[model samples]
Target: MSGSKKTYDTDTVVFGAGTAVIAAAIAAAKEGQETYLIEINNQIGGVMAASPGMMLGAGYPMKTSIGGFFKDYVQRMYNHTPPLARRRLSTLENLGEEVVYDPDYAIFL
Candidate 1:
């Protein structure tokens, strides 16, 4: 063993940079905790970064849905998309608790 390896002393250590993990890290940091988000992949969003047609299902009433960071990300995508596409997504949203967004934007966000 050598002293080359570094160490981190954090109040919260998130093991992934996926949507949920990222949200957890954000929440921890917001609570004034020192947080570390570790991601094995070179990119973030996990499968979502590649899955362009990915839509997250909340499996509940939209009124009681948990927004958090994920919601903010989705809202950001809405601004990136065109009006016609926004209209389409709006139609879909009327039917279910899901959000459709571009994958490339996911990585950028």
Candidate 2:
């Protein structure tokens, strides 16, 4: 190995490409910041992508309305051509609301 080193500069560097981190990166980019997302796997979405057919729980326990990136993300899913996601109650009682979505569609979105 050579003694040379490479460094990159970015306004925002989000570790892991999970749903939350992806959202954070998008938010930063929208704010005109240079953002970078790093993920170990070839794909993003973390556990969501790793486990196919997984549903995202929103407004858990509180069941309150959620806004910001999460809300927008869900809206995008619903607004897709065939509707990539749907709002539903969790099978487990205390889990509150969930967003059931197609993994493939979610990744591309």
Shift in Å, residue 31, candidate 1: 1.2
Candidate 2 lDDT, 37-80, residue by residue in tens: 88887888876665544335544555644578877877898899
Would you list the C-alpha lDDT of every candidate in the order shown? 0.66, 0.77
User: What lDDT score is found at residue 57 in candidate 2?
Assistant: 53
**Model 1: CA > 4 A from native:** 1-4, 56-58, 61-64, 80-97
Measured by TM-score, the strongest candidate is 2
Q: Which stretches of candidate 2 lie over 4 Å from their true place?
A: 1-3, 51-61
Error of 1 at 46 (Å): 1.4
Model 2: number of backbone collisions: 0
lDDT of 2 at 91: 84
Among residues 3 or more apart in sequence or in different chains, the pairs in candidate 2 whose N, CA or C atoms overlap within 3 Å are none
* Candidate 1 TM-score, C-alpha based: 0.70
Error of 1 at 102 (Å): 2.0
